[model samples]
Target chain A: MAQFLVEGRELVAEAARGLSALALRRDDAAAMEACFRALHTLKGSTGLFDLEAMGQLLHAAEDRLAALRDGQASTPGDIDALIEMVDQVDRWFDALERDGRLPADAGSIGQAAAHRIRDAGGAPVMAEEQPAQPSWRIPPDFDGLSGIAIRYVPRPDCYYFGDDPIAITAAIPQVTALRLSARVPWDSSEPYDPFTCNLVIEAVSAAGRAEVEAGFRLVADQVAFAELVPAAQAGSAGGGPARRTLRVDAARLDRLADLADDLVIAKGGLAELAAQAESLPGGHALGQALRLRQARLDRLAGDLHATVGRVRLVPLAPLFARFPRLVRDIARSLGKKAELVVEGGDVEVDKALVDALSDPLLHVLRNALDHGMEEASTRRRAGKAEAGSIRLAARVEGDQVVIEVADDGAGIDAATIRALAVKRGVLTQEDAARLDDVAAIDLIFAPGLSTAAAVTTLSGRGVGMDVVRSAAASLGGRVTVTSAAGRGTQVQFRLPVAMTLIQILVVACGEERYGLPLDAVVETARLAPGRVVPIRAGWAFQLRDQVLPLVGLGELVGTRRAALAESQRVVIAKVRGEPIAFAVDAFVDRLDIALRPMNGLLAHAPGMLGTTLLADGSVLMILDLAELVA
Target chain B: MTVRLDGAVLRLEGSCHLEDAESLTALLQTSGVSLVDLSACQSLHGAVVQALLALGPRVEGIPASPFLRDLLLPALLVKRQAKPSNL
Candidate 1:
C-alpha cells in the first residue's frame, strides 16, 4: 500500500509537470495529451485505492483538461489556470501522503477547480448552463483483439477554436497501428470543409484501455478506444511458442534472497568445521563430503543472488521519458534551437540507483542548456548547424553504470575559467598561467566557481557542479568531464551497480581495523622513513614524476599510537583526482561485505564510510579516504 | 444605499467592498434569505462573494462580468467550501 501511494504520488507529479509544460506551450498537442493522461492515471489509481478525496479532485482537474484538449478554450491564461489547479491537486496529494490525512477544506479546492473549468469557457449565469456534449464514433473490430474499446466525441463546435485531434491520438502508447477516417463522408456538396473533423480511428494497441482512453480525454466526447484480443497466431513466435514470464513482487524476491543468504552462511560454517576435522587424524572422508555439499550450496546461492538482483533491475525509460518536455521548455526559455537524443534507454539498473541519479542528471541537463549550448545565431556563425544537440546515453560497463550527457555546443573556454579562478582567488596568477586547458576546465567543479558574468536562476549559481560531484561520490561514483572548445563537451558519471555490498580492502592502523574502498585504493606498499623523500612543505614520494602526499594513517584517523617503528607500510589512496598515501602499520585481507550504517554518532564522523560485521564477531569501520583527503 | 426585501427576493445596494461584506452577512443572518441579487451594487469584492458562499446563499449578478464570476466567485467558492461553517 505504501508503494502504491509512492507510485501514485510520482504519477501526480508527472501530471503536474505535463500541465505546466502545456501552459508554457499552449498549442502543444502532445503536452496536453500527456497532462490529461497523468490526471487520468491519478484519478483512476486514487479511485482504485479508495482515496475518494484525491480521486474527486483529480477528476475535476481531468474534466477541465478534457475541455481544453477539445478546443473549447484557446487562451494561454486558460491553460495556466488549469495548470494552477493541477499544481494544487499535486500538492494536496503530497500533503495527504505525508500526513496520512486530507485537509478539512480539500473539497472546496475541487469545487473551485470545477468553477475554473466552467469559467475557462465563460462565466456561468446559473446552474442551468449545460456543458456541451462532444460527438464521437466507434471503430469497427476494435474489440477483436481481446482488449477494451472507448469512444469519445467532442462537440462539433470544438474545432472552431484550435484543437487538433491527431496530436492527442499520438500520445497513446503500444499503438501498433492507427487509421483515422473522417466521421462525415467527404462530399463536394458539403462546401469542401477542412476544419471539421468527423473522424473514426482504428487502432491496434496492447496498452490498457484506461491509459489510451485517458490520452483522448480532452476530446473524450469525440474519441473512442476499443480493446480486442489479437488472434492467437497474429505475431511470429520464435523457439516453438512465446512463453509468458511470471511477474513476482519485489518484496517476495527480497525475502527469498535473504533466506538464501542465511542458508549459504550456515553451509559455509559447516564446511569450516569439516576442514578442521580433516586437519585431525583420519577425517578425510568427512572433509570430502563437506566439500561436495559446500559446492552445491554455492551454486544454489549464486543463482538465487543473480535472480534477486535481476528482480531489482528497472529500465531507464522513466528517466528518458521526461527529457523531451524538458528540452522543449529549456530551449524555448533560452531562445535556442536544441534537440535531445537518448540512447540505450532499455539498459537496466537497480531501481534505487535510478532514483538517486535523477537529481544529478537534472542538474547536468540544466547546466547544459544554460551554459553549454550555444545560441542559434552563434552556431551558424561558427559554421555549425543552427540547432544544437544534446545526447544522453547510458550503458552498463563492467560493474558500474555509466551515464553520459554530451552536447554539440560551444564548449567550455579554458581561458575564461582560468581568468575566473584567478579573479575568485581559487588559483594564483602564477598557477593559473601554469595550468593547461584541461586542468583549467576542471576548475569548474570547484566550490563557488563559475565563469559566467551574471548568474541566472537556471544555472551559474556556482554550486551545481560541486553538488553533483559530492552526490556522485556519496554513491561511490565519480563524475568526469571532457571538453574541446567550439566542438562539444561531455560529462560522464560512473555509478556502482548497487550500494548494499561493496568490495573493500581491509587495513590495520595500530590496534584498530578499517576498510578502504578498493576503487579508491591506488596501491599498498611496505616503506621505511628512509625511502620517503621530502617535497615542498610536505613529504612526497616520486612515482613517475608525479608527487604523492604522504599522510600517516594513525594521524589521519586520530588513532593513538607510539612513534612509527623503523619498518612501516603505506597505502596510497586517491580522493577526487588527487593522490594521497596513508602510512599504516600493516595490510589485512580484502573481502566483500554488506555495508551497514554505522552506530549513532560515528555515522557522521569524517573518514568513515560505514560499518560491517565480520565472521569473527568483530566490527570493522569502512574508511572514506575521499572525504578525508578532500 | 438601496436595500429591498420582497418576499424571498433580497436586493443589495451601493458599492459593496470587502469592508461592507460583514454587514451583508449580518443582514443574511437576520433575514434568513437563501437568494440575493447584487445587480444594483456598484462593486463587489472577494470578501462579499466569500460571505455569500459562507452563508450558503445562491447569488445572482452580471453573468459576463469577468471580475465577479471568474475571479471573485471562483476564489470565494474555493475558500468558503474548503472551510465550511456550522450555518
Candidate 2:
C-alpha cells in the first residue's frame, strides 16, 4: 500500500503535467497520449488493491484523454475537469498514505468527479448515435469481416473548430482498414480554402456498433455506422550508457546511510589499533602491516560514505513540476495573471533536504502568488506585463545549494512590514522607525507579523515567512530577502548540500578536542599577552577594529580553564552575525566528519551540536556556537 | 512556431497548432517549398493538416503517433494519388 501511494503520487503528477500541457496546446498529441497512459497505469495499479473508487475515477479520466486524442472537440472546461479529477485522485492518495484506506467519502467524491469529466462532453462514445448510413462503400476484402463500418463526412468549417477527421476515424476501436476520399470532386482550376474540410472518412472496426460509435461520438452528427458481416475465410494483416533505477523506501536509504556512517566510525578503531601495535615492544613491523591495512580500510570507508551520499541525492525536477498547475489555479482564483518559471530543477540534493523543502517552498510560492503578485489591471498601470512572473531557481554554489524565489511583481513594502511589526507589538514604534529598509524587510521573518492586510484562504495567516525562516534554520541554512520598490523581491535560501556530513574546524582546550562548524568560524588569531584585557570577571579581546567578548572553551564546556599563556590562540566565531572570541589551547586540523546527534541521556545536552569519531577512535564533541553563545 | 521552412523543406514539429496553419499555407505558396516533414510532429491542428491536403505538397516522414501516421500519410498521399494534377 505504501509503495502504491508513492508511485501513485508520481503518476498523478505526471498526468497533471501532461494535462496542463494539453490545456495550453490542444493539439499536443504527445501530452494527450502521456496523460492517457499515466491514468491507464494508475487505474491498473488501483485494481491491484481494493481501490474501486480511484480506479473508476482514473478510468473515466483515461477515457476522456483517449477521446481527446481521438480528435474529439474538447470543451473549454475539459482540461480543467480532468485536472480536477487528477487533484481528487491526488487527495485520495494522500488519504491512502495517511491511513491504509481512502476516506469513507472517497466513493462519492470519485463518482461525482467521474461524472463531471464524462458529462463534460469529453466522455468516450459508448453507444451509436444513429444507424449506419447505407452509402458507406464497404471494402471488398472485408466481405466476410465481422465488425462495425463507419463513414464520417465532417462539416466544412470543422477544421476551424479544431476537428481532425482523420484522427477521429483512426481512433475507432479495433480498426482494420481505413479509406479517405474527397466528398466533392476537386475542381483543379479553382483556388479553395485549405481550411475547408472536404474528406469523407470510412473505417472498418472489429468491434460492436456501440463500441465503434464511441470513437466517433464527438462527431456523431457527421458519422454513420454499419455492421460488417464476416466472410468465413477473411484474414487480418498485422542505453547508449544506460542508467537503471530501483525505488527503495526512503527509510531504507536512511538506514543504509546510518550503517555506512557506523562503518566509517568503526574504521577509526583500526588506526588506534595500528598505533597501539606500534607502541608494543618489537611490534614495529606488525604495526607497519596494520597501518597499511588501516589505510586500505580508510579508503574503502570513504568510498562507501561517498557512494551513499550520491545514492541519497535526488533531482528537484519532480518537486518543481507540481507548481505550474498550482500557479494556474491560484492565478485564476485571485483574478491575477502569474506565471511560475522554474529553473535548475536538475540540481541534485539529499533526499532529506528535498523532502524538508516541500512545505517551506510551497508556502513561499503561495506567498509569492497570493501576496507578491498584483492584479492584471494593477500590473498594466504599473507598466509591467499583465502577467506577473515568479522565477523559482536553484543552483549549486560551492558546497551549498541556493534556492531562490524571485518575483517581478510589486516588491515587498518595507514600510508596511515595519508598521505591521509595530502594530503586532513585535517591535516598539521607535524600534521600527529606526530600522533601515533591509532590516524592515527582514521583519517579515518575525513571527506573528503578516504583510497582508487581510487573511485569505491562500495565505496571510500570519504564520508564514517565519516558518520558512525556521525551516531553513533547522536545515542548517539561512534565508535572506532583498526588494526594490516597483521592481521585484528575491528571497534566497542558502543551505548545505547535504546534512549527513559536515566540515568542522577542530579545536583543543584543556586536553580535550572539539569541533566547530567551519561556517561559524570567522578567523583564528594568536593574540599576544595583554592584548586580551579583563573586563569585569569576563575577558575581552581586541581583533582589528572590534572588541570582542571572549570566553575560554574549557570553562564554557565545564572543564578547567587553561592557564593564561604568553600568546593565546583565540578563535573568532560569528553567532547570529555577532563576532565572539573563544580562547583555545591549540587549533587542530580541519576535517569533514559525519556528526551523530547526541542520543541517550545526552540528547538534550545544551550547546552540544553532536559528536564525531576521530581517526584515533576518540570521540569529538561538535559545539553549536550560536546556542553555546546564547 | 511549430511550422518552419528550413531551406526548401517545410518542417512540422511538436504540436502544430491552428496558428501555424496560415504560415504553413504561406510557406507552401511562396517559399518554393518542396516537401513537408511530419517526422518530428506529434500532431497537427486540423487546419494545418487541411493546408497540407489543399496544397497537395509532397510529404515525407511519419509522425510518432500511430493514429496520426495512419491517417495523415495516407490522406496526404491518397489525395495526390487520386489526382496527380492537383499538386
Candidate 3:
C-alpha cells in the first residue's frame, strides 16, 4: 500500500509533466503517448485494491485521450482538463496516505471530475457504466488455431447484479483453451474485497460465432469477441543498462553512516595503541606490524565511509522537476510572462541537501516573479524581451554545489534598499547613508526588512530573503546577491557538497583537543620567544611585518587560558577576510569524522560548529573560527 | 455444508454460494489451511472465487465442473503466481 502511494504520486507527476508539454504543442506525439501511458498504468493499478472510483474516472480520461489520439480536434481546455484530472488523483493519493483510504465522497468527486474532462473533449457524459474492452491480442500459444476468442471484463458490482461471468465463459461449447487474469495487477498489500468482481475471464471456444455469443447473453455488455488466429510476436526493444535501486528508509542509511564513523574512530584507537607499543623497550617490530595493519584498516574504513556517502547522493533532477509548472502558473496568475530555464539538475548531491534546498530555491524564484519582473509594456520600452526569463541553474564547483536563481527583470536598487532600511528602522539614517552599495544591497537579508512597497500575496510578507539566508546558513552554506539597475538580480547559494561527514584538523589547547575545519586553516606557525607583543585588547603577533590579532583558543570557549610558552605554536586562519592567529599547545592528526550538530542546551552556543567523537571516546568540539572571532 | 475439512485438505464438495465467502475466508485465516481440494465442486459464486483469490491456499484437485476447472481455477492460480507489476 505504501509503495502504491509512492508510485501513484510519481505517476501523477509524470502525467502532469507530459500534459504540460502537450499543452504547449498538441502535435507532440511522444508527450501524448507518455501522458496516456501514465494514466493507463495508474488506472490499472487502481484495480488491485478497492479504488473503483479512481479506476472508473481514469477509464473515462483514457477514453477522452484516445479520442484526441484518433485525430479529433481538441478544444482549448482539453489539456487543462487533463492536468486537472491528474491533480485530483494526486490529492486523492494524499488522502490515501493519511487515512489509509480515500475520503467517503471520493466517488461523487471523481465522477464530477471525469464528467468535466469528458465534456472538455465534447463527449457525452456517460449515464451508464460501460466495461472498457481489454485490448488483448490473440494469445501466442493459440497459434494456427481457429476459434472465437472471448474476453469478458465484469463490472466491479456484477456480483450484486447476479452476473456470474466465470460460469458464463465455462458453459461455452467446445471450449479448448482458456486463460484468466485480473484486469489490473493484484496488490497483495491491500485487503481483498470479495464482493467487488476483479476478474477478466478469456477463453477460446471452437464453436460457431453465434453459439459463443449466445453463451454470454446474460452479460453481453461486458464481453468482447475476436476471431482467434496466429499472432505474430512483437519484437522486444533493446534493454538499457539496468539500474535497480533499493528503497531503503533514510534512517537506516544514517545508522549505517554512524557505524562507519565508529569504525573510523576505533581504527584511530589502533594508531594510538601502536604509538604506545613503539615507545616500549624492544617492541618496535610489533608496533610496526600494528601500524601496517592500522594503515590497511584505515584504507578500508575510508572506502566504506566514501561508499556510504556515495550511496546517499541523489540526483537534483527530482528536486528541480517540481518548479516548471509552479513558475508557469504563478506567471499566469500574476499577469506577467516568465519562463524558468533549469540546468545542471543531473548533478547528484546528498539527499539531505536536496530536500533542504527546495524551499529556499522556491522562495527566491517567487521573489523574482513578484518583484523583479517588469510589466510587458515596461520591458518593451526598456528594449528587453517582453517575457522575462528566470534561470535556475546548479553546478558543482570543487567540493561545493552552487545554485543560482537569476531573473532578467528589474534589478535590485541599492539606493532604494538603503532608504527602505532606514525607513523600516532596521538601520539608522546615518548608518544607512554610510553603508557601501554592496552592504546596502545585502540589507535585503535583514530580518523584518522587506523592500516590497506593499505586501503582495506572493513573497514580500516580512519573512523573505532572511529565511533563505538563515536556511542556507543552517546547512553550512551562505547566500549572496548581485544586481544591476534596470538589468536583473541573481541570488546564489553556496552549500557544502556533503554535510554529515567533514575533514578537520585536530588541535590541542592546554590538555583539551578541539577540531577546526581543514578548509579554514591557512597555515601553522611556530612563533619565536618575545615575538608575541602585548597589545591593549590582547596579544598581537607580527607575521611578515603585519600584526595579526592572536587569541588563545581555550580562552574563547571560557575554559582555562593557555599560558604563553617559550615558543608558541599558533594556527593562522582567515576569518571573514583578515588573518587571525589562535594559540594551541600541539597539532594532532588530521582525519575525516562525522560531525553532529549541537542540539538542546548547546544548540545556540556561539563560536561552535558542532562536535565529534575522538578515538579515546572523548568528545571533541569543532569550532567555526570565522564565527569564533566575529 | 459446501466447505468441510477432509483429513488435512479443505474440500468444497458442492456448489459454493455467495454466502459461503465469509466462512471460507474465516476458515482460511484461522485454520492455517494451506491446501484445498475442489474435485467434487460444481459451481463457485463470484464471491467465493474472490475469497479464494484473496486468501490464497494451495489447491490439491481440480473440480469436475468445466467452468471451475477451466476458467476460475486458472484465474485464481495465475493471480497467485504473478507479482504486482506496472509500478
Candidate 4:
C-alpha cells in the first residue's frame, strides 16, 4: 500500500510535467496520452486500497485527458484545472500516508473535482452526453487469464437516474464468480426503501482492467476494482515500481553510519595494537599476524564506510523541481516575469545536506527576485530582455558540488553596497573607502548589512545574505558572490560532495590541534624568511609567482602562539576561488575521521567544525577553513 | 451460504467465504462426483478458487460473473488438469 501511494505520487508529478509541456503550446497526442497513462496508473493503484475517492478523481481525470487525446480542443483553464487536480491528488495521498486515511472531507472534495472536470469538456459533445455505454456484464463460464475483483455501490438514488446496479455488475466481462451481498449489520436498520439501492454487487472477472473500468464508467466514483493475484503471488503483486525502490526507516541508516564509524575507530585501535606488539622481544611473530589481520580489517572498514555514505546519497532533482513553480509564483506576485532554468540537477548529494540546503537556496532565489533583478522597465532600459532569466546550475567540481544561482538584471552597485556598509555601521567610513568592488560586494555577506532602501515583503526582513553564507558554510561550503553593475549577479555555493568521514590535514596552532579538510588544501609550504611579506593583519606567503595572504592560526582562533621561527608551516587553501594561506606551528599526521556537528549552543558557533577523537584519545577540532578565512 | 447435496450432485448459492473451504473440501471428498452447480453462487473467496483447483470439481452452471468466468475459469481449468486426476 505504501508503494502504491509512492508510485501514485510519482505518476501525478510526472503528469504535472507533461501537462506543463502540453499547456505551453504543445498539441501533440503523446502529451495527452502521457497524462492519461499517469491518471490511469494512479486509478489502478488506488483501487488496491480502500481509496475509492482517489480512484474516482483519477478516473475522471483520465476521461478528460482521453477526450483531449481524441482531437478535442482544450482551454488554457482546462490545463490549469488539470494541474490543480494533480496537486489536490498529491496532497490527498500525502494526507493518506501521514494520517492513515484521507482528510475527513476527501469524498466531498473529490465530488467537487469530478464536477469541475465534467464541466471542463473540450469535445464537440460531452462524454457524459453520449448514450450510456453497456455496463460490463459477466459471461458465464468465460475464462479470464487474470481475475479482476470489483465492488460496486451506485448512489442510492442512481436508479432514479435510470441506472441499474445489477445490470452494471452483470455486464462485467468474463466473470467466474458473482455475489450480491446484503447484511443488516452493514447497513441502517431503518425500513429499506424499495426504490433505493441497498445492494453491493461484488464480482470476480477475468477481463482486463480497461474493459472492466469501461463497463462501470457511469459509477466509477462508487466502485472499487482490484486486480487480484493468487494469494501465493499477492505479496509480489503490488506492482513493478514498488519492487524497484524501497522505504527504509531513517533511524536505521543513522545507526548503520554510527556503527561504521565505530568500526573505523576499532580498526585504528588494531593498528595501534599491532605497532605496540612489534616492539617487544619475541613479539615479532604475533605482531606479523596482527598487522596482516589489521590490514584486512582496514580494507573492510573502508568499504563499510563508503557503502554507508552512499546510502544517504540522493539526486538533487527534488530540490531543483520546486524552484520552477516558486519562481513563477514569486515573479507573478512581484509584477515581474522570470523563467527559471535548471541545469545538471541530476547530481547526487548527501540527503542531509540537501535537506539543510532548502532554506539557503530559497533565500538566495528570493533575494535574486527581489533585490538582484531589476524591474521589467529597468531591465529594458538597461538593454536587456524584458523578462528576466534566473538560472540555477549545479555540477561536481573536483570533490565539491558547486551550485550557482544567476540572474540577468541590473546587478549590484558596489559603490552603493560600500555606502550601505558604512551607513549600517558594518564598516567604518575609512575602511569603506579602501574597499574595491570585489571587497565591497563581499560585505553583502556581513551580518546586519542590507542595501534595501525600505524593507520589502519578499526579502528584507532583517535576515540577509549572511544567513545564506552561514548555511552554505554549515555544509562545509563557501558562497562566492560576483556582480556587474548592469549585467546581473551570480552567487556560487561550493560544498563538499559528501559530509561523512573525510580526510583532513591535521596542523597545530600552539598546543591545540586543528584539522583542515583535505579538499580545500591546495598545498603545504615551508616559507623562508624572505618569502614572507608583511600584510596589514598577517603575513603573505610568496609561493612561486603568487602572493597569497597568510593568516596566523594562533591570531585567527585566539590561541597562544609559539615564538617566531626562521621557518613556518603554512597550508594554502582555495577559499571562494582565491588562494589564501594559514600559518601553523607544526604539521601533524593526516587522517580520515567522521566529524559530527557541534551540539546545542555550540552549533551556532562559526569557523570551527565538529570535533572527533584522535587515536590517542584527544579530541581534534576541525576548522571550517573558508569561514576561518572570512 | 450452504451447499445442497443430492446424490452425487450439489448446488452452491449466495456468497461462500474461506471458512466454507474445509466443509466444501470434505463434501467433494465424500461425494463421488465433482459436478457442483455454482450458477447461483454470486461470490467465492480466493480460497474457494484454490479449493476448486485442488478438488478438480466439474462445476455445472458456473456463476455468471465476468471476473469469475474470465480469471478463475482459466485458473480453474489449468488447476484441474494439474489436480492429480483422482481427486
Order of candidate numbers by lDDT, starting with the best? 3, 2, 4, 1
Candidate 1 local distance difference test against the native: 0.66
Candidate 3 segments exceeding 4 Å error: A45-57, A91-113, A123-243, A276-284, A325-339, A375-389, A422-440, A460-462, A499-501, A526-536, A561-566, B1-87
Give the Cα RMSD of candidate 2: 13.8
Q: Which stretches of candidate 1 lie over 4 Å from their true place?
A: A1-5, A9-41, A44-225, A229-272, A315-347, A369-393, A406-411, A457-462, A484-489, A520-551, A562-567, A570-582, A597-600, B1-87
| Model 2 lDDT tens row, A1-630 | 776776787788778878878878987644654576568778889999989999989887777776776567889988889988997888787678778898999899989998998898744457422222367567564565556677788998887777877666656677776666677866658766667777777677766555676788888899876655344211110011122456787899999998888788788678879899999999989999999999998999999998999899998877887776677677888888887888898999988889889988888888888888888888999999999999999999987899999999888988899888989999999999999999999998888887788888888655679999978986778899998988888899998787567789999887789899998898999989989889998889777788999988888888886666899998889988899999899998888789876789997788988898776767899998887777
Q: Give fnat, all candidates.
A: 0.00, 0.30, 0.47, 0.02
Worst 10 residues of 2 chain A by lDDT: A233-242
Candidate 1 structure quality by residue, lDDT tens digits, A1-630: 575555565565556556656756765654655566667666767766666766766666666666665555455466656655665665665567788766778777777776776676464323321122223343443423443344433444445544544334445666554443334543434332233444444555556545676787666766544333243312211112333544467678657655654444445456677788778788888888878878887788767666766777888866775564567577878888887777777888876677778888888888887888888888999999998889999998988889999999888999999999999899999999999988889887888786556787777654668788877877778898899889988999998775445778988877888988887888887765676676664566765677677877777788764455576677887876787888777888777766654558775787788877665657788888877766
Model 2 residue A161 CA deviation (Å) reads 36
For model 4, residues A122-227, the per-residue Cα lDDT tens digits are 4423543221222554323222323666777667566567675655665777765655433122222443234444455567766655678899988899887654
TM-score of each: 0.57, 0.66, 0.66, 0.60
Instruction: Tell me how far the alpha carbon of residue A350 in candidate 1 is from the true structure, in angstroms, after superposition.
Output: 2.5
- Overlapping backbone residue pairs in candidate 1 total 35
Best-to-worst DockQ order: 3, 2, 4, 1
Best by DockQ: 3
Every model's DockQ, to 2 decimals? Answer: 0.01, 0.21, 0.27, 0.04
| lDDT per residue (tens digit) for residues B1-87 in model 2 | 788888878999998877788888888878888699999998776667667766778889978887677755776686677766624
Candidate 3 global lDDT: 0.80
Two-chain DockQ for model 2: 0.21
lDDT of each: 0.66, 0.80, 0.80, 0.74
